[model samples]
Target: MDTEDTTGDLITRTGFHFHIRHAEPEDEAIVADFFKHVTPEDVRFRFLSGMKSVSHERLVEMTSSSDARRVNFLAFSPNETLLAAAMLAVGKDPQRGEVALTIRDDYKHQGISWEMLAHICRYAERHNFKSIESIESRENHAAIELERDMAFRAYTDKDDPTIVVLRRDFRP
Candidate 1:
């Protein structure tokens, strides 16, 4: 079940081998289907809005390979089922980036998010980024706890009482 592609690498987690690669323009449908499987609350947590469905243009932006500042990774099971998606949006400062991730509801509590976050962090550090950040809903306790366990500092977003900004600083 091992494979490789131009987008990125393949890795196994908990006996399930999956590909962790950048999303291609042709992957719009796949991403759309992945979003369809996400819960409403999960969608709110991921988008920070009550988005019941992702728009086509937003999906295009997510799948676009031309955006140098943004990198979106889609994880697929060995059988080619989309299991999760993670994104990194680097800022103009180069040393800081914002990250977001979502896993299918059925895949939660299986160490997938942890592995994806670790992989994304390594990717950021390798690209010379100094820190990675995520804005999470205060009700997203699972994600907040996961980020905290990964050493990301969490702070209340003053402008939005319902949001918490979590940051992980990488050592040079």
Candidate 2:
């Protein structure tokens, strides 16, 4: 049986609602669409490098890999449409971790990102991780604010201009 981490319910904030669930094989298509909308430009902004697309095979590997270092999750709307996604990777230290979150373009500024991050943070905390980090584009102030509100320390290097790292301590 698939064991659930800490984030096993619907998270509601403001006027929006989303649930975090383990992504299954049946979700491949919507997940692919999520990545498609994620786009080369979006990837470049998030990664600070151009990426055309993430392959389906790579996603499958990320979800089921025995490494257990990473796990995939989907944020679905009340109507069951995907609104956002997050992949949390547990590092070798167990106390170190990283996360990536994406919101559907059509649903921007609808509180989807906030709910997703909250769930990710809660999940990280329950796992005994010391911190969870986010790498984002310097221009994405909205994301920066979200991270800040979640109590993360954010850094953007002038030399590296494009990527900002946001770190939130998970250990209490």
Candidate 3:
């Protein structure tokens, strides 16, 4: 836990007694466990499909997938329990990034989602991404409200009934 990156920054930081860090391969199961707490309803809103349960194969794919510009972050409770998670994906173009976040159903409305989103945005900026996009179902008003704090250009999807795209540029 005391390992330091080449830049000399500590790998873990404390916030409200919780530890936030770049997730590792060993943390895959914990991420899977976190996904278990995310209900079908949550998936429905984000994926536009009512996914009852995620398969282990999918979990493995997510944790093992490698792209130089992609990074996943986890929020661990003081007890070292994964409470929430998010990912910052930089497109083939370094100037583009997109964030996807999810919080435990039981923990919703407690501000974890907002915190996770902010963390991912900051991460994206630190990596020099010029802009980030969030794709969500129009029915997910909470997500819409969350992005309202920033200026986003909205685009309607022609094929998807429940989807809308929001794009935001990161100002250094």
Candidate 4:
């Protein structure tokens, strides 16, 4: 099903109009191509490692999941060009979920990330999750600040000093 905002507005920014929908198995290749367009730093932040390339297995893990706990969302331009991707992985505890997002390098600073993140949070809430969490690298200042602006509390990961955990509670 195609997901739309409450107002039925297509996400648009900087002259780009996008359709956001839940990703399917066929989108594995599309996701791979999207990753190829991102910067190396983005890859590191997404995978938490400085890998030279995203492996097929990893792409499969992201796009084709039989597990109901995971959901991947993809944003496409009017011409169907992949613009960004976000993954929501709910833990065994139904009350919480982890989210990760990456935007095309060329789409950065255009509010796509912000819109995608808001959509993810709404998705989590609709799924009855009380909170959402994101693990971000300390060096990713833009994302860190974005999360902060979104009201997600940031704290250093005890085991990984290089990582910061951001969490936002949806419950009152």
**If scored against the real structure, what TM-score would every candidate get?**
0.91, 0.83, 0.80, 0.91
Instruction: For candidate 2, write residues 1-172 as lDDT tens digits.
Output: 1227634556455666667786666777787777766656666655466668767786675355244677777888778887777778866677878888777778887777777778777777777779988888887788889889989998776767667889998666
Q: Residue-wise lDDT of candidate 1 within 1-172, one digit each (tens)?
A: 0112224444545655566888889999999999888999998999999777899998997788777788888888778888899888977787799999999998777777887788888788777778999999999999999999999999888899999999999975
Give candidate 3's error at residue 162 in angstroms: 1.8
lDDT of 2: 0.73
lDDT of 3 at 84: 71
In terms of lDDT, which candidate is stronger, 2 or 4?
4
Assess each prediction's global lDDT (C-alpha) against the native. Answer: 0.84, 0.73, 0.66, 0.83
Worst 10 residues of 2 by lDDT: 1-10
Residues 87-150, candidate 4, lDDT per residue (tens digit)? Answer: 8887779789999998899878878888888888887787678999999999999999999999
| lDDT comparing candidate 3 with the true structure | 0.66
The true-versus-predicted C-alpha distance at residue 10 of model 1, in Å, is 5.7
Supply candidate 2's per-residue lDDT for 127: 71
C-alpha RMSD of each candidate structure in angstroms? 3.6, 2.8, 4.6, 2.7
Error of 3 at 90 (Å): 2.6
Which regions of candidate 2 deviate over 4 angstroms?
1-3, 65-67, 156-161
| Candidate 4 lDDT (Cα, 0 to 1) | 0.83
